[model samples]
Every structure is written in structure tokens, then in C-alpha cells.
Target chain A: MSRLAAKFEELAQSGRKALIPFITAGDPSPGFTVPMMHAMVKAGVDVIELGVPFSDPMADGPVIQRASERALAHKMSLRRTLEIAAEFRKTDQTTPVVLMGYLNPIEAMTYEGFANAAQRADIDGVLTVDLPPEEGQECSALLKARGIDPIFLLAPNSSVDRVKKMDAVGSGYLYYVSLKGVTGAGHLDVADVENKLQQIRANTQLPVAIGFGVKDAETANTIAHLGDGVVIGSALISKIETNLDNPEQAKNEIVELLTSIRQALDCGLGTEGVQE
Target chain B: MTEKYNMPDERGHFGPYGGIFVAETLIPPIQELNAAYQKYLKDPEFIAELDADLKYYVGRPSPLYHAERWSRELGGAQIYLKREDLNHTGSHKINNTVGQALLAKRMGKTRIIAETGAGQHGVATATVAARLGLECVVYMGAVDVARQSLNVYRMKLLGAKVVAVESGSKTLKDALNEALRDWVTNVDNTFYIIGTVAGPHPYPAMVRDFQAIIGREAKQQCLEATGRLPDALVACVGGGSNAIGLFYPFIEDESVKMYGVEAAGDGVATGRHSAPLCAGRPGVLHGNRTYLMADDDGEIIETHSISAGLDYPGVGPEHAWLKDTGRATYVNITDTEALEGFYALTHMEGIIPALESSHAMAYALKLAPTMGKDETLIINLSGRGDKDMQTMAKREGIEL
Candidate 1:
């Protein structure tokens, strides 16, 4: 099994909701990225999502867009992002790192190049926001051949028919965007998400992760109760932006938020020995 | 003459401006377009469809009307207007959209996607999609959704799905972002119907070729009416499709001077301008290397213009090439000046032109007074201003 699948299975067996923290690589600089990954893992994050910055990020909101801009200002490319992952793997090998970004950069590098680079860098999975499963056959096949799970996003606007289509190609955890617009624009419609999750669960046996607007602890806890995993992006990027001038403080703040969410999910799961 | 039509010199320069400065993924596609266009230009079927559509649907042979009153008011030259505003969908934008949609059908693509600002291009794409029975998706900025709600409704009514993008600055540039994302995802079965001459290689060339009908007809009409071609050809330069179309056929005619008018919201010196050719430097934007108003760090600066259609910071690569080669001159017209021309044309000639075309009218107003009485000038009236009526009324403090 892939690292992402194993992590999901372990969380399922423990009856614990997985906590995923998203960070854009090279936001502060390449020098600070590996340490930041270590910090998130130490704070009890079950999965780490590293964002590969693209010149045009359409699905991201203002906070993440700002973070991407900062990264791009440093001339962050896919090669540099993978190098950061490779550096992190030297110290820590167990944490599952999934590269989440738009498809342009990956497409800019051919599918074979991306698959080989991800494998060599110890990257476990990829979730391209714009690459739907129906159109990702070549990339998915390439990644699957190399044991890297290709994750897909299912949204409220996606129909049951579309969910079945995604199920055929989607592996590892399926990301469920709670809203229709870009990330961080609106409040989470919990009922709408729950209904969509239930519909998606009926179609696919893959683990479902809810994202897009789970900002505070309350929303994260609520979403964790209904879904297999919770993905946090804009709020984490906002924290990093607040403490950007001081890297240590920024890492501390991000870890604090992840720790609190991890503890809350553990409490809901009734897991006795899970570390927060 | 044949050399004039050929493109991309040894160094990828289109008269010293255009070049392929794109991601490696797009290299194959750009090369494919170059090869396809070369062959397609000679194909009888391709020429037939394009000609038939231009004649029947686009209402080609748009008249060259003598604006006698406005010309007399200028007190010098006899000015004429090429009436592209009379085309279907109320703008010259339809000409390129129809051609690209037909190409998409020929390429065996079943889905089409486009990006829009004031929704002129969206309406044009939706119209062609409905005609061709292709599924259409339009990406528009959230701010534009509120401003151009009627056009959005029109697009939906024509059976196209409109996705409002609330990212970046929430403008035309952001709409372009979403459309790029959609194109990358569905590239296999989808054809991106780029509306302007600003994207990667063949798009700039293809859109210009489709719009070239404007200059071809205008040149004939001007010669028939005045026994000689106009001394000057003026047109607005937002992405430069209409301007290039009206200027290409006349490029070899040294007697006819060409002027491209860009939008100057306040003034070019104030940094609140869309004068890409007048003030911008060479840069890559929207997949094509062109002249763009970029900052010290090469980041695209936000442009200001009263006309949403003219608010982009980058001009088409072909226009940049034309400007560099000294084949065409570019100038800036302020919002106030364009507004004056807008009202002047509406009352004087009974033609309410698009705010974009009004920029050209404003330039003509300035140039006509300086020319001799024997001199004739032609200005491209690119589109009707009905879509901008509400904005104009609001700006004039008139309530709906």
C-alpha cells in the first residue's frame, strides 16, 4: 500500500479523524521549508500537504494566493519544491507528504518526469486541483505504476454520476471541497457537505477528506466527525503570513493550531493513547 | 507579398516582438497550430466555411459611412467609419469567436471554454457554441458578474455554463486564470476559444486573420468612395484584434498611416493607464511575449480604464511587433477624452459605439483637425455601446 493509504487505514482502525495541514513550499524560503515540515509532523498532523506554487492559481482564495505570490517571488519551481521534499525525507521518512497544486506546473514537466521526481523525492501522492479524473488518465496511470496515489477532489456541485466517474481513477483519500467558489470565500454548509460526503461514500470505498473552509477548531471538529479526514489550508497560510517576519514564531503558531485540532479529533474518536 | 504573410523569423521574432516563451507542455501545441494554420490556409473547405460565415452570419461588407457632420466639425479631413458595430452580437468580437468555434468543430472537440471581462466575448462564444451544438463553459470574474449581469444571463440563456471566479483581483485577468485551469484539465476533448490576439502563437495570428476582413473590406470601400485610400487608419488597441485586423491589409500601403489608440484612464504618467504600447516594456503575458506594463520585479501591474474591455495591462504580440517595426504608431487617449467622443458620435452620427471603439473616435477627433481638407481617415467603430449603457448612464449621473 502507498503511504497515504496506510495512514488512512491506521486512522480508520484507531477510529480517529486524520488531520491534514497544507503549506506552500518556499513561502518564506527553501531554507525554512524542511524545518516547517518537521514542525507540522511533530504537532501531530496525520498528513502533510505541500503546495507547489503556480503563476496562476485559480482555485485558491486571497490568503493562499498571497502565500503563492510570496513563493513565486522566490522563483519557486517544481524542481525546487521536490528538493524541499527530498531534504525533509532525509530526517523524517514516515510522514506521508502529498503535493497539492494546479496541473500547469506538472503538465509543464511531463507526466513521466513528475512521477519519477515524486518517487525519488519520497513524495507519496498528488492532488491537482484542476485535473479531474476523466482527463487525468495518463498522469494517473503513470503515478499508479510508481506506487504514488493520485487523489481527486469531489465538490458539492459534483453529481453522483460524476462521483462514480471519479471513483474509478481516484485513489488514497478523496478531497471534498465544501463550497463551489474558490477556497476561503464562504462559510461551510455543513449539511450540504455531509450530504455530499454520504453520496460519495455510497459510490466509492475510498477515504474522504473535507476541505476548503474548515478554519477554526469548531468547524474542524464538526467536519472531522462527519468525514474521514479534515484538510486545513487558508487558515494555516494566514498563520504563516502573520509570523513570516519570524520563522520560529510562525512555525510555533502553525503547530499550535494543528495540535489543537488533532486533540479535538482524538477526543471525538475516543482514542486513549493517541498523541496530540 | 508572400513574405509579408509568413511569420516567425529564425529567432522566433514576429517583426522583432512575438516569440514562443511558454512552458514546455505548450510547445507541442504551439507547433501544431503553426503547422495546421499553414496547411489550413490553403484548404478550400476551411476558406469556404470562414467566408460563408463572414458573409451570412457576421454581415460582412459592413459599410464605410462618411461622418460628414463630425468631419466638418473637425474642420479639416473627411473622416469615415468602418461599421463593424453592425455585425451580429453587436461587436467585432463575434468574427474571431465564430472562426475559432468552427476550427474546434473541425478538430473534433465537443467542448469549448472561454474567459470574458465585459462579457462581449462570452456572449460571442455562447452564440457560436449554441449554433455549433458544442458544450460551452465561460469563466468570468465575480466583479464582472455584478457589473455585466445581463450578458451573463444572455450566456446562460444560450445554454452555456458561466462559472464566476472569485480569485486574485476578481477581474478579467482572474477570469483568464480560471479558464487556463479548465483548459489544462480538459485539453484532450476541449478547445479553448481565446477571444483576443494575446495568447500563445497561433492564437494571436489566427484571431488577426479572422479580423483581417475589417481592413480588406474597408480598403475597398474607401477606394470606391474617395478614389484613394485613407491617409490614416485608427482603431482601439485592447488586445489589438480589431486594430490589427483593420491594419494588416494596409501594412504594405506606405501612404496610409496606422494609429492604435490605447486607454489612458487618468494619464499615462500617473501609472494608471492601459497604454501597453505607449508606456509598457517587452514581457511575457497570457502565454505570448508582448509589451506589458509590468513592475520592477516583472509582476503584472493592475491597469485602470473606464472601459472594462480596455483594462488589461498587456497588448497583443502582433501589435507589439508592429509598433517595434515602425509599421504602426500607438497613442493614448484619456477616459474623459474618450467619453467626449462617445457622446459626440452618439449625437452627431446616431451611433452608440463601445467604450473601446470610443478611444479610436477620440484619436480621430484629434488627428482630423490637423490633416488637410483633401486627406481622408478611417476609424474602426468596433462595437455598439448598448452593453455599456448602464455604466455610461451611471457615470453621467443618470438613474436607470
Candidate 2:
């Protein structure tokens, strides 16, 4: 089994939901990402989704876009992002780090080249925002061949056929975007998300990680009940955005925020891994 | 030449150059749009309505006026101007907007949105939306809003709410990202009228079909006037709508050559330009895979051009496929050369061309002199220079 499979199985065995926290690599500065990854792991994040900064972050809202701009200014790139992941893996080899971003950067670094670099870095998975299954055949196959799970996104409006297709092609958890808007723009309706998750559960067997509006402890805890995991992206980036002038303050805020959500998950989290 | 010149096989790949590469949230909506577009494309009723709108509303079949004076001065091939500049909205942009607006109404959409670089498409979208009594909103780069203020005011007068996008590079691509954001949020009642032959699947093919009216007319006019097809076709390519508009219908004409002029701001060598087809590699951006001006790190480089419309890092996917397949030759013109073409055409033929169109004019000037006098060339004059008077005046050190 792959690291993602083993990790999810371990989470299920412990009856604790996965808490995936996303942060753009090199956001605060070039020296900021490695320390932050260790900090988040210490704060009980199950999976660290490291955002590879691109000049055009179309799927992201203003907060994450700002994070990308800051990261890019430090010359952070796909190669640099992988180097950071490699740095994080030096001492801590158990935690799974998933690289998440747009696909052009990966295209620039050829698929075979990226897969080899990722394997060397011990990266676990990849979630390309704009790469749907229709265009993901080659890239997904390459990642899967190298034991890196290709994570696909399932939206609120995904059809049953698309869900099935994603289930067959995607190896790791499926990210369910709870709302119809860009990341960090709209308030997610729990009822709507719950209803959509039910349909998605009926169609796919891959673990579903709900994101796109997992804002606070309330929203995160609520989302934990609806899916196999909860993802927090812009909300965490917002903390970094607010504390750009002070890296220590930003790290403290991120740790504090993730800790609260971690506690929220532990309090009354649903242990039901896939509906009976 | 034995086979028909069909492209972008059903899945929208112009030989791996175009595909629907968007986030999952946009999948259902774009799929819905594709179904509607496919259904209405051959529908007699839809075609009739679109044709009527083009003829009566947009004043279509725009004249193919021979630029005899300019051709004589060039002392080479005969030059004819396919006068899309004389269209109702003063550009070829209106051709796509009118078709999409009518389609939006039929699809039961109540809100219309668009993104623009030079503001021509914004005004065109707003005009069609106002005619259809739908709410209109346009996204433009903050820099373009200041430079193309006349078209900005024109869009407002047509009842569009103009939003200046203050994001990455703050140009055409940024505006497109903002418009995509808006569409994802309001997919229920909103219809995004993509102004160029770019974006996701159906958009490139659909816009090409609508704007193909230009090539259809120009071909017929050239055949009627000269009793033979023109030897060459030239057009400026920003998102490549105008160029594709004039080239699609002639793709099977083995003897007819095509040239797409890209904006080389300072020079491609100086690394300050948007000549993607001329000096770029294939990459995915703005919902399609195409040639893009990206660094080795895959970050889009900031593109510079005297024409706002052409200052984009990526070109339409079809243009990429055309360049690769050798169906079209892609050339580039610098800001200085395009400006000279603008002035030359204005003085010689009494036709003031848009800075975007002047790129095509510049390339034609070079090629016309290289050809024999008996040969013929047609340049798609995609837009008028009325909106560019201020920029020209600024260049001349005169306060407009």
C-alpha cells in the first residue's frame, strides 16, 4: 500500500478524522516553509498540502493569490517547492506531504522529471486544481507509477459519471469543494455540502476531503462529520497574510489556529469512515 | 488537401493544444454550455436569428475595399482591406458578442459577463447585453481601464458595470481570471461571453464559428472582384479571434497562405513582448493548453505591447496548433514598426487602424513589397483606431 493508503488506514484505525492543512511554500520567506511544516505536523495536521506558487493562480481567491505572489518574489518554484519538501522529509519521514497547485509548473518540469524529483523528496500525493480527469490521464498514470497518489477534486456539481471516473483514476482522497465559488470567497452551506457529500459517497470509494470553505473550528468540525477529512487553505493563509511583517507571529497564529481545529476534531468527531 | 480542414476533434483538442482544463466547480456549467452550443450550432432557427442579427443589427458583410493607393505606394502586390473596422461596434468583437448574447437569451440566462484587454470587447458585450435587456458586467485590467478610457465610458453608457481587475500583471489574462471567478459564483443565471477565440472547449470553437463570417465574406468578395482567390491572408492575433475569423474558412484552400502577426513590444530578443507563437512553448493557461510566454519556472512573464489587446502572455489554442502544423506562419512586429504601419495606412489609404490591427498592417507592408504586382493579399482590418487616438497623441507628445 502507498503512504496515503497506510496513513488513511491508520487514521481510520484510530477513529480520528484527517485534518489536512494547506500553506503556500515559501509564503513568509524562503526560510519559512520547512519550519512551518514541522510546526503544522506538531499541531496534529494529518496531511500537509504545500502550494506551489504560480504567477496565475486563477482558482484561488485574493488571500491565497497574495500568498502565491509573496512566495514567487522569493524565487519559489516547482523545483524549489520540491526542495523544501525534501528538507521537511530529512528528519520527519512519516508525515505525508501533498503538493497542490496549478498544472503549468508541473508541465514546465516534464512529468517524468517531476515524478522522479517528487519520489526523491518522498512526496505522497498531488492535487492539480485545473487538471480534470479528461486531461489527467498521462500525468496521473506517471504519478501512480512512482507510488505518488494523484488526488482529484470532486465539486458540489460533479456528475455520477465524473465521480466514477475520478474514483477509478484518482488514488488518494478526493477533495470536495463545498461551494461553487473560488477558494475563500463564499460562505459554505452545510446542508448543501452534506447533500452533495451523500451523492459523492454513493458513487466513489476513495476518501473524500472537504475543502474550499473550511474556515473556522465550527466549519471544520461540521465538515469533519460530512467527509473522511477536512481541508483548510485560505483560512490558514489569511493568518499568514495578516502577519506578513512578523514571521514568528504568523507561525504562532498558524499553530494556534490549527491546534484549535485539531481540538475541535477530537472533541466529537464522527468515526464513520464511509457510510455503512 | 484531399481531406477537409476540420480541427479540434469533438473533445476540443486542436492536436493537444486545447482542452477544458478548468476547476471542477466549472465543469458542470461548461458542460451545460457545450451541450447548448452543440445543439444550436446546426439549428435552423438559431442560425437564422444569428444571420439576421449580423446583417441588420451589426451591419454585416462589411465591404472589402481595395486599398489601391496604399498598394501602389508599396509598389508590389495588390492589397485589399476586409473592413471589419466598419462594423457597428467599430471592431470584429461585436461579431462574437451578438451571437453569444442571442445564445445566452435562448439558454435562459439573465446575466452577461465578459473580460476585455483593449475595451473593444467590453463595449461590444455591453451593447449586446443592453439590446437583450440582460444585466452586463465587464472585467478589464486596471492599466487598460486608464488607457482605453473612451471605451470604458462607452461600456458604462451601454449599462455595463466595469470592474478593473487589480491582480497579477493586471492585464487581459488577469481580467479573464476575474471573470472566471465571477462565473463560478453566479453560474446559475450568468453567461460568460468570452470575447476571444480562447478559454475552454466550446468557447474556442463557438467563437470561431460566429466570427468565421469574416472569412466567408472576404473569400466571396475576393473571388467576385478579382475572379481568383487572394494569394495571402493577414490578420493580427491577440487571443487570435480576428485572425481565426478570417482564416478558418480558407484553411482548405491549398494555394492561399495565412500569416498571423503577434505583438513584439520592444523585441522578442529583449524579452519584453507577447509574441507567444513566435517565441514561446506550449503550456496550459486560462482553461486551455496553448503557447505561452512563461519563464523556465513556468511563471507567466509580464508581457508588454503598445496595443493593450495584444499584451497577453498566451495565444488562442488554435493558433498554437496552426503554428505547429505549418498551416499558418506566425510573425511578430515591434511597437515602433506597428506605429509606423498605423501612420502609413492613415496617410496613404485614409484608414486609421487600431494598434492591434496595425501589427497585421505592418507585416503586410513587409510582405506586400516582397510579392509580385500581379499577386493579391487581404488584410483583416480587425478594428478602428478611434479608441487609440489618445495613445497616438501621447506618443506624438500632444495632450489629447
Residue A211 Cα positional deviation in candidate 1, in Å, after optimal superposition: 20
Superposed Cα deviation of residue B104, candidate 1 (Å)? 0.7
Per-residue lDDT of B393 in model 1 = 82
Q: What tens-digit string does per-residue lDDT give for candidate 1 at B1-400?
A: 2335555553345764655544222334455556766677788999999899988998987889999999988898899999999999888989999888877887788999999987889999999999999999999988888887878999999999999987665777778877865764455678888888877667887888888989999999998999988999999998888999999899888778999999999999999988979998875566656788765435567788888788887888888877877878999999999998899899998999999999999998899999998999999999889888888888889999
Writing each residue's lDDT as its tens digit, candidate 2 over A97-160 gives 9999998999999889889999999999999999998899999999998999999998878888
Clashing pairs in 1: none
Residue-level error in angstroms, candidate 2, position B314? 0.8
TM-score per prediction, in order, is 0.67, 0.98
TM-score of 2: 0.98
- Give the poorly placed runs of model 2, Cα more than 4 Å off: A270-276
Task: Identify the leading candidate in terms of lDDT.
Answer: 2
Scored on chain A only, each candidate's TM-score is: 0.97, 0.96
Q: Deviation in angstroms for B358 in model 2?
A: 0.8
